[model samples]
Target: MEKVMMILAAFVLTSTSRPPEHKYVYVDELKNWTEAQRFCRQTYTDLATLESQQDVEALSDMATSVRKTSELAWIGLYDDVNSWRWSTSDSDFYQHEEMDFNNWQAGKPNNVWLGLFRDSWKWVEGKNFSFRFWNEGNNEPGNNGKEECAAAHFGRSGQWEDWPCDQHKAFVCYSELCGNASLPGRKYFFVGELKTWTEAQSHCREHYGNLAVMENMEDVGTLNNMAASLGFTSTAWIGLYDDVNSWRWSVSEYDLDQHQENKFTNWQPSEPNNDAGRESCIEMFANGSWNDITCSKLQGSICSEVRDSDVKFTFINVDMNWTQAQSYCRNHYTDLARVRNMTDIQKIQTLIPAGQNVWIGFHRPFWMWVDGSRFSFSYWRSSEPSGSGEHCASADLGNSGQWENWDCDGQRPFICYNVVCGNSTLPTREYIIVDELKTWTEAQRYCRENHKDLATITNMEDVRMLNDLATGRTSQAWIGLHEDVNSWRWSMSDQYQNQFRNWAAGQPNNKFGRESCGALSADGSWYDVSCSQTLHTVCFNVCGTNPTFYYSSTKRSWTEAQSFCREHYRDLAGVRHLSDNKVIQGLVQRAAWMGLYRDSWKWADGGNSSFRNWNRDEPNHNGKEGCAAANFGNAGKWEDWSCGEKKAFVCYAAVQSKHLVKLQLEFPSSLTEDDSAMMEELLIKLKQKLKDDGVKGDVKVSWRKRPDGKILHKPKKKKDEL
Candidate 1:
């Protein structure tokens, strides 16, 4: 019969708690945006989503606490320009013909469709036409030659006539009016983990709502406040990106409105003819007239500053490309100047030197949020979102949380958020040794029937624990560790694979193909040997931190040593690095047994831990040298040899414990007993409060439901013969 041992367990549940409206978690890991998103989904909620000022504040506070004042982290935001929508969706917003109205920028909306060249002359403003008054006597629009453009001949009763497109003639321009609006709520977190934009999006979608989306100035202000609290600044991913469509002002406010009079243009005759396809920026001639030009051209620029109802224009003599000029103006002034009317244009004209062109505030539109939120709110730093290919957005904490566009592949830390569910706790284990002599299989059976199972050592902490338990006990024992020759890995599984190694030269020569166990030499090198060899062993009790080594004079087979180590210590010793090998080498005077053996490298409890400390170029499987061992003579490097060789061995184990705390309850009348979700929220708050109060360890909080399925009840009113 198997003997089962019972350990102490305790816990407590209470009422009366309040959790934050939004919970944000800052992960410190570094990964691409997609990986970060996946981690967030698995570990917490999702990438931090900021819908309101409160959310931003929450994230800011968290960031300050972590002391990650200066760094960029991925958020749940991205760009999806392909999903375009009209600025206004109201059916009544446009009349029949108005719906087809278009005012493409110069040289845009490429003309690729088949159409009659001579008869297809269209309005420059993209307007439809039905009436025509041609210079009939002059055979106007005759397409007599290469006349691709039309001109109104004042000399002929104002009738239209075809003319060469390149001819320099006076032209007409127009303007229209536009307006802006706003929306609202959510929470945020400041993750310190780094990831790419796409990765961050995945993480946020899986774990939380989505990347932070700011829909109004209120949100921007809140985000700014959050960054201000940090006393330092850095950049982080946000939920805005460019889609490369539409056209708008750099300030984001003065967009094309509904009224025609509000729209204004002063393009010189046939001026905005889009010389090439590259003209995406606007430039003003010295005469205060406007024309479309390539954004890459260097030129002076005008900046406008708004004070109350008055606007002031300042000219910057520095020559730079459109984007650069925009940035400079933003950093030093309000923004590229906006000419609202002829008066404003005249004001700007006075600021310009003769015959000098300057950049203005107009630009092609392409920015949008990752979550499909309304693109109403914006808080961009001066000249941000300037680069053509930078379609991802990040918040510069150093700049009061202002936003900037960046490449999607650039790595950065991220923030994640989740709903408060309850408390959190971590699981642990303990180890013990049993004096016995048995084969590897028999030892495993014994441990399973007795203690939890054969000891499974993971980190140096486990080694330390085994060292503590080995004091005064038999120096030799069996442990629960083995290896699989086919797939090289440890039985306990984790995210990290064995990356560090120190191997002996030309090692692991399986003499007779029977070697399946590992041993250590006095000089700290490794070798495989037959499992039947008998060896002494070292054992440990607790798990955590640094590890110590011990040696015994007794000898046992590889299998016997493994069993002895398991009984006396945690398991066979697992040297993780040069330091660990050095420590073990100092203890052994000759050869000894270790935990590493060959099979499929698995823990006795069937853990999938991928931590392996091997010697360089070892386990070469030389002549079927399947077993592994440490050779102290070779700087504690590893080698492959037969398992049948006799040597001493080491063992290790982990220490485990649990605690429970009980508490009384109180609740506001508004909260009912059936509000389980609210109860969960309160529990989460309590957990956070504990953390705030310096409670450490893998502590978890939860409501221990009673047998009657109730965790809270109103206390019976006390009656005293009233």
Candidate 2:
């Protein structure tokens, strides 16, 4: 193999992820999952779409350094195929060229669909050491046996490179393949011997269409089993793809009814997501089940109709939260979850590891149907939520073949499933937001009416997350709690729970008559407010991490604070209105009068240093005195200090440790537990640090009304987050 030099090793996987509307870049230099999604949305766009093999190829060529050991970059759809539709528009056409110009700054497609095909990762060449992308688990890197997505690229000038499919690198995903290459159409009847999937797709496309598109479960089954019977293990192309659009099947007039089952078609459990138009093709897993995955995902697949029903879908052994599991099933399986028989249970058993019990469709959080029918009061192996408010429940196959009651609010573990297992299909469920805004009584009403309860918060992260959403607001909404007719009961039902009461100050004391609700507030605090007050509350939907590192520019001698902020912080902190500036202007005046001088009492970005007290009649610099600083003393007494003057600096860094921001978001990972523990330490340390540094007078830390109402110690439930 002839290798050319000159390619920069420092690869940059650039992508234009579409946020709610704007486009964002990954900036891999410093990004974690949460912040990465935030940056994509709040800053740029949502994420890049890797819809086709060509798109994957382009991205690999565009990305960099896939020397066989690179991290598998995330694309749009591993989670659920149905939800696999593009984040932007699920419309039929995606203008590929229009994307070339809109690609985000770089390193995007940060988030990925959470699907893990059985351990078969697509590498550059061989297996094992050759694996380029490294998925967190046996999650399908490449859908079928052959892995294609293992190939990723960075930079616009390098050669397309391949890596281990599981590698975790930022990647570029294209919506469609922009090229002149087009396959012609034709007809065939298995002339004599069998054909490799690749060969079949190529020949088929050249004659019968660009790869066959399987329409339904029957169609997929009809094809894969045929290939397996033929003893084919190679890869094949399929008409099913999401690039440009999802519905435009790769092949023309691809029909299933016209063709009869040819003795070899078959499918695995819950096959064919057709999610957002995903891997509509078939690739038999080593275990004989059919994995309907992403075409670009690159796996060893075969052509022809599926013919096997005995093929059980294999589950990728990956750990996921209940909400995540639900989401995954919806995307890939086209439903919530199913519980048909013991085999289905065994199939699901493959998802989580031993010692971990997760929530499945058999949960009875609110009401349980007696043989799929009504409000039957049923108690399980476990007792009620005696102490801690446990809202969600799970199956405890650990003991008797019955369900066990655990706190769904706890977020322990979860599993996803497909159909071929012959289990009944999953049902639909509309959630009641535990983190939504609602009054105590109002929240209870909403929960009772719906098939849910006021969302119960279970962890510190949830408390902090809820608070983040309720920031700048007053009055906390209610969480699922209250004195239900004299007893401390959960709105969902009386399930067995271990922990309880997370109240702030004299909380849940049945204030003013009786306390009937609990709520989380802004600032990671939990509390019990009066049931009558109106405030935003949150609901748990079950969800999901990562932080990016940021280092600000050191010194530029900005003449104006606004400019200084503009050059730094990426932009200015909330300015509000000019009236606010008027109040600040007075401080500039005093600073100028205090023996401080620049060309004039200039601002940091070079404007009239109208701070402190405008040295009598100021504005003499004609807005040129742009350096503004607070007087050495006085709360708002600002001054125009020289840009060259060196003073104690306040450096801003990207809050790399959201879970540990209170520890000053330190670089030392082992410093503290997380926000719940360190927040108290931070408050104490910040006060002490400020006092010792003498900045107490210069800079003050104003305490805002704690939204959660709880003191720094009380934690919350994880399910109560947005």
Candidate 3:
């Protein structure tokens, strides 16, 4: 089916307006990222740039007409050293920008190579160096190649310096033309200068409209046309990039701030430096300004909604984490109230009691849920979760369900909760102890085989139950809490459901620089390795009776294996427990990536659910890339998977029912027509006879569709063949 673009008319209903009339179009073609970008720009907007949840929803809605939920496409979102942007200032795409204005922290943008921030610098040829604000004491661009990019540091009066291109820093891109266009009117030029991603970003900012922002396939086609015109083929830089999930309104209406002036944010001078790497969620001060905090921090949640033409605000008095609070608000009312403008903010302010901090729907792009649950809460311990790499969270049952942020390998008593049981009829809370301590993944496996899963404590009662279970234990035990270091979510869950993680020791290292995928290692541990590696695959099948896992002898890449398993059985294996891992372990000996890959945390279905369960060490690798998998060795804790690696995977399917019903009848001997054809006629007459006796509703007489696509057919057979 061909994708059609629709201009949804705006209407007034609630307290705030929609963002803008973003024209969304979908391209039904297979092309790499660059080719897709070119096509979108020439035809419509750039490769369907998605800046807001509304934008994502709009594009998803448009694509649903031509694509399945599991199908993938090229959106204008690629991880080019973490700089995410759109082709123009379109309201929809701007949802990814944390703050529109520039307010850099002091000594910021000192582009550090590999993990070292230095006063370094280097000038790429043909790139504009016109803008300069050197500091007084050490303003020179450092000689180290690591500090190769520049940033506007608030510390040095907003001066600039060169920094590493891969440090996951914030950047500003300028498009000479910021207007949203339907067709290709402006010409995009290909600058051949060898520049870093940031330098190219700078060059584009200085030159033609910031590195050719493509809006749709037409725009992409224009670029492709440009490439064809110039015969240039190597990868040229574009404006779409990002290292972090930026902040957007919790209430994701398109016209919430159409004028863009509503984006005026009040922040403490030098606020949102992301103090630690984990500070991605937003917090509003009493004065209505916003600051970034870790999602695990405990705080009150502020929610707002439009009811009966009047915007109402509700301040939940509970102290819960961001995800938990999100679940609470969604379970009771609308999603965490999205504050679109000052009017909404003021409404929220009047409701919030003095000195009470709360979480709104506002959040950065990453740190989403695996089951696509609401990411509306955070409960991090103060001054905790201080790490530059990918970070995950764990709940501290010993501390009133308060959570602590730690590295991926931090060993602690993890928890898990189960909603579905294999045998039990009703929901039950059965917390079990494993005297034999193991990694988070191992512990998860142990709990699943014996019990439902690792324990999940949703409220104080559940936490108290855990406390009672751990009363006499000397040290902390593992629970079913997990978060993504990459902030990526599973494809099946779409970022709005609960997740349980179990990683191995020193695992998810993202070793050798290209480890964006995850693999289940021997002994049930998980590690982040390159996605291109080939290994055995695992498949899962959900037949009658119970879910069964299978190991395949054929080896293929993650994509191929996923395709094979999906075609033959089900999609790649999604191991939910320790029993799952042990079952898979029995099948294979070496390592392989599962169907679980990472997509930074996001909620699906707008605000579908808000439940999460993870082991302590999670969301590793700077919360960037990698899929998720359960490691049975660590109690089925989750880990990341690289999509390209060929690993044994698992697939599942629903039981197929046979239409032919067998009957043990008595008077058949008197009928005398025992041949198969005669039997068929007799069965038809028998069905009609039964219907005559009032055997209606699901007792209709119909022939089963044959394997050759025919409803009425019978195979001829010899006596021996029959």
Candidate 4:
């Protein structure tokens, strides 16, 4: 192994060079954030993604000649709040590193609702009432893998179980006490008469009062006793019906104040009898007393006028219904009179004829009882009423007891009650779960009718108690934890894992809890802003050897700019490095958008860079600002802004460099220029050697051809030898 080896040296010549890292372009077209992004991507690489002061300066210089001074241009920096966060937002509840705790199963949180079990349950009506009566024998909720609805079984002493929502079962409906115990003496009567809801209403009005308006739990108890006495264990019609058209005032502005003055009514001793179940409009007598009347009834209207902030009334002797009167008043005067206070009534009373009733501005409520009682008490099952076309209400007397909206034309047994001019009282009842398989909504109705409501868990102790209650029944049960789809998330799906942040002082404050976007400042800080603000935008292009940036002097909103960048370039510039911040900062003449936005906070590109540069107390999260912009006037810091704001933008593109490399080498005497294959082999070896020497990127090596259309020519003999 220690043998001496003869060595031969070969003469060679070589030259090499490299291209610049990136190139920038400045466009002077005036477009929105999105429009500018499109132009840049189509004409150049993409919106500029700055990475250093030099890069910013180059862009600035290029733009200075064509763009106005102090003008904001789009940049490739934005805000993204779409990141992973806990469902629990209470900061104090989590200790150090606890907020990051995770016990997810392998390949869990896969962004889809699969066969996983939910941590909690909820009532159909979304109430977190602390009560549990689950049938634990069969693992009740189990969601049964697909069962989302809950039901109570009377056979199980009111214990609950889960089932599919579409399952048909008898249900229960209940009404609250009217609270007005002085409204004459009312008694419930079971009409065993099978009629459509409409026909039933007509029959009830003609015979008793209106189909028994159960206004309270006492009323419910009364009806239950009556049904039990008659052994009528079946579904039946009730007076409560869906009045799809919501009540409103002729003046839209007054509608906003309706809630505050909802209790203000000047009914003339039960004047709103709702005769024939068709009275849905309001009328005022000369004495200022109000009455419910059919909307189709023709009558004179009282119009109001606003003069010097004081309302005045004008009576029009036109015979028109509520709708026509409203239009007429709006065209001729301000609008139908709105009785805000006693003063308004007095003013309108003076204009009314001695015994005439004039139309007023009030309309009927969405839900109404045939007896003209206030529709205050409700016991709707979870996601019930369908809200599609079902207008009539029905009570399930045999199954998971609950209230539901039904078709008015559907025939069913009915319950009717009469007023007997005497006071009456009812007794209390105990909770009893119905024994029937029905939807969660249906179960809720049954519970509300027979008991109080579905169980609502508030704490772990409640959970334990519920578990104990369901010990021998179903294992899973419904509680009251509705899933909210609205949460912090990133716009770019792939960049969700990024945790980098750069906030300005007091930024991301989520002021008013509306801010959800991110922004960049001139000083290289970050901020939380709105997504609708218009600003300059930045884009990036990585199609070349290296990332390059460009500046579009057009203004656009954050989203529009994003669409433009993604459509043409790689995406909005994602500055995951301090170097990138510096580069972007230098180019900023004004605040611009970047790829640092968030539904929670993420970059436009799916980069894992975690670099950040924030000003003190940044990301205040003020307003509904959900987009990110870079403020150049403040030293290229970041601030959240409305994405709809139009401003200039920046984009970037990638480029490749070519170098004319030359090399000379001495070979053995036996090797000749005609050995083209050997020369190619040598070039390949040279390329490999360069790679081994730490050279990156694409490298090519080839022999240079001479004027004689040949390469690797033999060297000429020395002058002395000649």
Candidate 5:
């Protein structure tokens, strides 16, 4: 395919006047010529065989084209089929050069015979400074011993010669330029020395009205022509940036057409990632089109500016870890724009930019909203909260980016929307609307075809202020919740509908496909639609949760008398945060570890409480420090630290389905009738299983015990013997 492509490219130059529009296909840089050719054919095309002067001119912009005015490229010309002819020898277009391109470097055409191989001449010049070539098996040039050999050329100036297939050198990447003309209306082009996007943009604007923008191969060809005129080599930049998943034009306003389709496109694998969440810029040259690039890089760039409108605002990664929201805003937007008021949000609805997501200044408490409003509301998903002391809110401009309250000091990537707001509202139910470029369905699709679920209303206050707040949206948003399939369950149960749903009248009918999605009501209920229907929606996922009795337990050594938690009731559950501790403590009747110590009586659960809410100071250690247990009926069943007591100790493990996953499923029964309810069953099983599984136990040597409970053949038994 590579050979065929190059030939076709040659034919195109012979037939047209346009310069070559080639996009270099990168290969393993370590590849030799033969392997490189296979890779190109498999990736870009065959080794480049220049067939036209225009092709020659266009190739001038590429550094790897490797035509040194004399060095001959290995085209699809071989006599392997017993016929020595150029692969594409039809059309009588072969160059009748004034000098042979197959240069013979100092007797390089000599064929030497050695060993058992048949006698023949080799292309060995016999010196390191001089090039040599041969057929190893028969020590001959040309194809012999059923082996393949190739002819080399030094163009018209150097001597003609032959070479062994094993020699290594750089090869050319060519495409069938005769295919469909390149896509058109691209918004940026590369020029001169590589420059960072900002520098390039500035330079481009000063020169050819912003770097050339190309959306198609024809446009690429035109740029190629432009580059040929200016003399550039190697890869350069285009206007694409990684907004998120793929590359999109940086100055999207200048975009006139979309990208074109080409079979010879190249990709450097797993690229175009904008995952640090902030990088939304794009670049060219990893095989072809545009792939996302890191914004911090100083790569070559192409800029675009149409005659009708001027694009301002440059994107830059700041130099400090101490970037303030206000500083970021001042640097990007004008004068720390008053906390993104409703009007601003509405205006931003329309200009969703090409690719980027960021938090606006509306989040307060973290930062003072100049509007002098009390920090009273929230729009959090389940477990919505405030006062971890974070008062700032980041709004997602792309709808795909969600709105969230973040720590004031947290570092995050941000986007600056061109549409100004905090001013007025648009007169449409749809403040801003964008299509869902990627196909999706109701349950699967985000509220906005381009964004996530929907808009949210924190409290009745926000809802009342919403029509005014959502300067762009008069209608309510579709929350993430609704009846999925047949059940009337929200997609995320955590995001329960706040009191401010604006469902259309008589909505959310649970009839079959009717209640598949969530559409806010003008009054109360939500309207459900077919899960496949694509519609706009909004959500507010806001609610406040106070610190409460969220409880969980951990492992502690125990015995048979108590079930896990109740053993250290006073010590473990001792109302540390007095309020929360007491809150759940009332419900726990059985005594459990109050996370306390009895010997030192130190609280085991770990806290700074010096006072133990003990039951009348009853933690009297009876010499042997056993575990503690309390009678719930006893007043303040607390404060007990007996580590060795035997009780039906409750051991906790995560429950899967209804059963806990255990290392050893089967337990062994012990013969010690006095051992109280087979207490060692689990331990014995673990030891035996570990042995069987080749897991060694502490290898301390021990003696066998006699039936009479005495050590066998031992002089004296140690007091601490097990």
Candidate 6:
């Protein structure tokens, strides 16, 4: 059954001298699950936990009274899956079974379309130990009666399967020390005789540590080498065995460590169905609703903190979003309340007089940055992000940087950040200001071409920079923050990789479940959609050089634009400077194409900073497209694009900043006209004279029109003067 898992600790009121009531702090902040936990632990008790229906009612009442929107305050309840340990008994390997809890970060062991296959299998390895390459369908472990031994199919995607023992087939052996190499040797050899799984295990145990325990892809590669060397083809047994119902919670039993069984079960209807055998983690919505979900999806979390004082509870009365509340509690009180026994539950009932929802530290998994950064910060608007289709996030310049959820397909303005070049100075950071209303992907391409890739904000400093840039702007703009949901990457190769994403409401629907692209919508939100659809794009180029962008009215596929760019100039335009965006934005009116496309959401700079700004349910991956674009019409947010779509595109050329300045010179009327003509000749002499003067920098001069919009020329003699 999928029930919200929580860590319980009892605090009983020993003396009647103490007040019969506990204080429940209602902090209103917007933070992800983990951040709230830290806040609660540091400031107050852990997130409020409910021991009974009465406790739930009390918390609900307080939440209903205080909450501004339907946003649920975090509670001390979460899923405890992915906490498997290895059979080897070394706890280190499984310490973080929940390390990259999001399935996108570390694909889970379940039956899903993972590329192409749906097989049910169990890891004999500890609940913490999860690593597999199983074959499709019935070839998986526990597939047939009496099929208990596991083997690797070397030729076909290196997947694994179970087979009956006593079937004579080749086998691979594992050794912590093999062939006297001292190294944990995986020297596999084709043991010619077909033996049952048990027999193979015994033989390998005698010769080495055990049958080849394939730990990672590297081990599989080693097996491939062994198979090639021996030329033995057919099924080969390895050490893996099946213990089908071996699921466990990641929560430490030491909160009573000895108790492994879940004492409580509160599952929603049709929940814990183990959909596709992947829904192992538990979660609860506001209203005390409980359900099971895959560990990979992203959600707000709940955390606990022990209090040194005698007070069993503290109620924060501030009204912040979940993230904000978590930040407040962490700074002042402990984390969200962590209710343990019925005593604390009763105390909570007496503490809060109203209903309100707040944030606790609970990790509900979702799309994660491939760089593996923490999901700590969030800034969501009220009653925002309400949809199941797909969503992305956007920041409203009109609303003091407040953000709202949006659709990836919708076009909008966006923001992009740059890596600090020389030092930690404001001038060292480059920002691209793409004014053209292009799709998020196009803006990203423009930014990459002129300045850096889309802006990648690191902390509040970056956000401030964006706000400062948006001071007089009415429409919000696009930033280099977006998510593909399947994975996150950057468009440019020279920029830093920061995990900062902004999605919109129910965006990224991935309508048809194949939309792997991203876009920016109006309201500065992000969305996902098929890349083939055409939209406006932004482009940028090197300042002081020839025009950076080359607009072609003839629409072409993204691939074709890339080809055209490579052939004529450089690969599609890359924006590396903020000024460059402003320069290029004036060139296009409608949505066009840029070089930016979705490739597992990796950053071009490769610096892993996990910061996401998703609007709401987003990155739906509809239409089987895998590209990205920037939407300038909608405030420059982001959305997905298709590589094959034919759209107007922007290309750029790289050039260094020119130090020379253009000046218009007029000869004094006193001088003869011949002197002005001789001025050109005199300039040659002046150049030599300056060289003799030993200037540190080179000086180059060019002709320019006068302030009156006319080229410099000898003033015509006034007729009266003549």
Q: What does the lDDT read for residue 116 in candidate 4?
A: 28
Candidate 2, run of 10 with poorest lDDT? 1-10
TM-scores, all candidates, are: 0.25, 0.17, 0.25, 0.24, 0.18, 0.20
| Candidate 6 local Cα displacement, residue 567, angstroms | 84
- Score candidate 2 by TM-score against the native: 0.17
Angstrom error at residue 422, model 5: 42
Judged by lDDT, which candidate is best?
Answer: 1
User: What CA RMSD would candidate 5 show?
Assistant: 39.3
Write candidate 6's Cα lDDT for 160-203 as tens digits.
55554323333221111112211122233335444554455444
Can you tell me which runs of candidate 3 are displaced by over 4 Å?
1-245, 254-262, 341-346, 367-722
Task: Provide the lDDT at 345 for model 6.
Answer: 42
* Per-candidate local distance difference test: 0.56, 0.30, 0.47, 0.55, 0.30, 0.41
- Compose the digit string of candidate 5's lDDT tens values, residues 514-611: 22334322222235544334322221111122322223333222111111222111112222233534454444332222221111222222222232
lDDT of candidate 5? Answer: 0.30
lDDT agreement of model 4 with the native: 0.55
Provide backbone clash counts, one per model: 139, 170, 166, 186, 112, 213
RMSD to the true structure for each prediction, in A, is 26.8, 31.8, 27.8, 35.6, 39.3, 30.3
Q: Which is the better candidate, 5 or 6, if ranked by TM-score?
A: 6
Question: How would you order the candidates by TM-score, starting with the best?
Answer: 1, 3, 4, 6, 5, 2
Cα error, residue 438 of model 4, in Å, equals: 31
RMSD of 1: 26.8
